[model samples]
Target chain A: MTPQTGRSAGPGVPRGDLPHRAGATGWFDTRHRHLGDWAFVVNRLSGLGLVAYLYLHLVILSQLARGPEAWGGFLAIATSPPVLLFDVLLLAGLLAHAFNGIRVTLLGLGLVASRQKALWVALMGMAVLIALAGASRILGVTS
Target chain B: MATLLQTPRPGADADPAAPARTLRVRRHRRGDSAEGWDRYTAPVGPRTTVLDALTWVRAHLDASLNLRHSCLHASCGTCGMRVNGRDVLACVTRLEDLPPGEVSVEPLRNQPLVSDLVVDIESLYESLDGVRLPLVRTSEGAPGSTPAEGVGHLTRFEDCVECGLCVSACPIVASDPEYAGPAVLGAAWRLVAEPRDRDPEPAYALVDGEQGAWRCHLAFECNEVCPTDALPAEEIARLRGILLRHRVVRWLQRHARPEEVQP
Candidate 1:
């Protein structure tokens, strides 16, 4: 859609604001942002991913209602390498959301207010390490 | 996507004879439904600021170009604008200090666009009004710190210049306009921290709700962009602490025996 009077937006930028700050886009725009802002973006994106995964998980579980044959067929698809890779991605999203969520909780309760930057780095570091371990386990790279 | 320039240190602009720079400035006027960019070549020196280049373009290239400034220095905070997606004072931000390339200049976000590079900052002042932010600040009495020989106390203007930079940079303000932004929240914390005989309850009442300190998702973008180093997010957290303690005290009062409740 044409969002400006004189200028047409570039392809894939269907929702540019009227010569203003990118409103909802700021949630994903990390180019000009700081560590805390990136953390918020990561947390928001991961939260949405986890919610989607939850619904997908429930729908997959509903296959059990179709009897043993259908359940067995679905299990064949579920344990495939592609599905396992998707599980690794889901694990990473969960770790990012959960760890950053803890950091946000501390901030909201007025704890460690001054050391926020340091706190974000520490928490995100833990999230990365845990995500790496989870990914290796899901991909069967570890014995 | 607009070509954004990388931020550079101030000391890089030591040479005087710099090349002509490209300024891709945002353009709009009254009754316009949307806005667009206009590219202009500004012949500039090494020390030439974004304000200087824009003023030059206005004088020679495009007279219709509208912008606002007064102090020329950063003290007035009137020349605030976004250079390459970053909020800054146009007068103080030199073009050369930004990485060499085409620079995109836009009006500050989260404020009513007046036209071109000017934004109406009435919301900022209106938010400040809720807390009645004082101009001068009481000094901290650090050990061995002394005032001037003839002076009894040390006082100065608070760090916040009411520039609205923090508001413009805030992601919460972008989503929810009613959210009291960092500038005002920081001002509120000042009153609560040092009541100086005034009741801090009113300030507490203004920012204790969902639209206040609690709404801040801890982006801390305000702290990053504040030219004055106000540490607004930190102040908001501290304000939340005060509000929490106040609520706990009132809850205790209500639960106590009628005669035992402290006045």
Candidate 2:
């Protein structure tokens, strides 16, 4: 009996010509979502967000070198409620990124790498706890 | 043979009169053909696995349906395919785990397609050949003659079954064909980590390239899809750590002993 070959191209046709489909995205494929994958996605997004915020913060701080008037004008906008809320978001992103970074480092060190799911849960739990505490302090919601 | 193929689901209520389930297999006539998929409805029950359905279809409905499976159990690792868009072992995946609609079966990814539901896994094995995997014991001691105190508990490192499923699930291998995949790298780590292996330098050289451990994005899909719990992603991470440590040591040595460092 003739075997049913999966590929239909002739010998002369290059393999590259065939349709080659990778994951749903280059790295983030929602179709193959797992717990570890979700963690990776969150870590990547948070890291990028933190890097962008770093550059933005530096740009804003550079205005201080211009003059007191310029600095005071920028500070006024920075201290606004919307800016404060954005700071809170940045704080949450920073905490998540930092904690997840620690988790990845620990995994690299082979510390509790076998129980990665548990480690992720524990790190995420810590991130949430720290973010909540920081948010409470930022909003003056103590008590 | 059909009776032997029946694998009852765990804690599943036995139903003798269950209705038949459909196994829709995606077919490609050649590497560039446009033939999409072929559907086959078989008399499936709770005990039927994806492999059993394929076998039934081949034996009864379409004799031309090509698939490969050796050990009906998960040991042989020959029946790896995509079921419902996820890489899985056909011999072990049960019908109950699939959704309510028709079960879809496709060939494994990151490899050349041989036929319907059959891929060229020899490419994976060929990649392993470049790593030079062999126990390199330099000491002229007999087997089991060396001290087994700390080395006895290293069974976790030797869990690679070389199924190629990890290669299929690995995104790096899909994106970059030159990248030595998780399975081969995991095997390299296993060989290198063995205390009895006196010469691990070759394995180190193999993994110290651009397509080595650094290429992995730590997606952890290989660990998730492995049926034997090999944890290849963990092994790759350990390999990266080892490589990083070696690089650091070499850098320090070069800086400290400038006379000994060769240009």
Candidate 3:
């Protein structure tokens, strides 16, 4: 066992069981508190998801330009079992993306303070709503 | 000739009052190939400002002077120019407030100079559009009922005015073109931080990718130069923290429910 230090193993600590500390630095200076790192990642992922959805939706809608026969054919294929599974995955990603945005908004605006539970509930609620709407669309329920 | 002395008349030019100091301003005349400073002398009063002195110059000395000033107050934000190499609003900056005879004025930096003082600000508008700075409103207001209620944190993050000062002041944009400047980030933050903006996770992910929020070195210069006091660096930091938390949550959820974890 390597000597136990006051810092947590930061994804690369080998053969050492160190007490977890929030931040650590070399002997000379302390590490800077960079809380914004996660927001940056989430923004990128969600943005990509949104962009992909926009493009995919546009491509799927192109059937209209090809006439009603093309549209009906495309719809038939989209409702297949494999496609429905893919749609569920897409819906999950979409809901996650949207909820993450809500979390950022909450903290950024100084509202809801630091209550993680409340934020989670709000995010989960949005996901449920989206999932419900997606299910209705998938099941061919009339408006 | 017998000695005869006439009493000097002290009525016209002499007075007991203290002499007023003359403010000499450096002017860059238009149509002059070499834009150099020309001294414009003005009598200073107790409430005189740099704008007042420049107004005097334009009125008395140079009729063809070129400059822009609207609502000689801080509201318009149009009077932001370089004074002694620092950005400040000319209307509010008093001449007496600064060191005497040590004043210089120049147009805003890092923008296309249109003639003398005005710059082409249309590029800023275009850049804003590039970032898609729009309120992600829900499908049209349903009759009198409000659009689908946004999450709890949406309203406060929507207060950005797109002043361009933050962008102009950002060192990142100056050095890296791919680094979407502070103005863009601020808008992104507003969306990510808004409860009404639907899914902020995607926005967060967007900023985390290459040449995005990670590119920002936490210089705090953008926050310093922001006239609106929007603490953009802090906002960026918060956004990053939220993203990390999201990852942790995902990891925990996946680990706890292996069956729920999708392939």
- Global lDDT of each candidate: 0.79, 0.74, 0.55
lDDT for A17 (candidate 3)? 17
The candidate with the higher lDDT, 1 or 2, is 1
lDDT for each residue of candidate 1 in B60-177, tens digit (9 for 90 to 100): 6677788998888888888889999898989989988899888999999988887888888877887787787643323433456663442221121265778888888899888778
- Badly placed stretches (over 4 Å) of model 3 are A1-143, B1-35, B129-161, B195-206, B243-263
Single out the weakest 10-residue window by summed lDDT for candidate 2 chain B: B1-10
Instruction: Residues A74-94, candidate 1: write the lDDT tens digits.
Output: 989988999999888888889
Q: Write down the TM-score for model 1.
A: 0.85
Against the native complex, each candidate's DockQ, computed on alpha carbons, is 0.31, 0.27, 0.01
Question: What lDDT score is found at residue A107 in candidate 3?
Answer: 52
**Docking class of predicted structure 3:** incorrect
Ranking of models by DockQ: 1, 2, 3
TM per prediction: 0.85, 0.79, 0.47
Weakest 10 consecutive residues of candidate 3 chain B by summed lDDT: B1-10
Task: List all candidate RMSDs to the true structure.
Answer: 6.9, 6.5, 26.3
The alpha-carbon interface RMSD of model 2 comes to 7.2
Candidates ranked by lDDT: 1, 2, 3
In every candidate, how many clashes are there? 0, 8, 35
Residue-wise lDDT of candidate 2 within A1-143, one digit each (tens)?
Answer: 23345345677865442233474354566476576777777888888898899999899899889999999999898878898788889999998888888877876654565677888888899999999999887776884
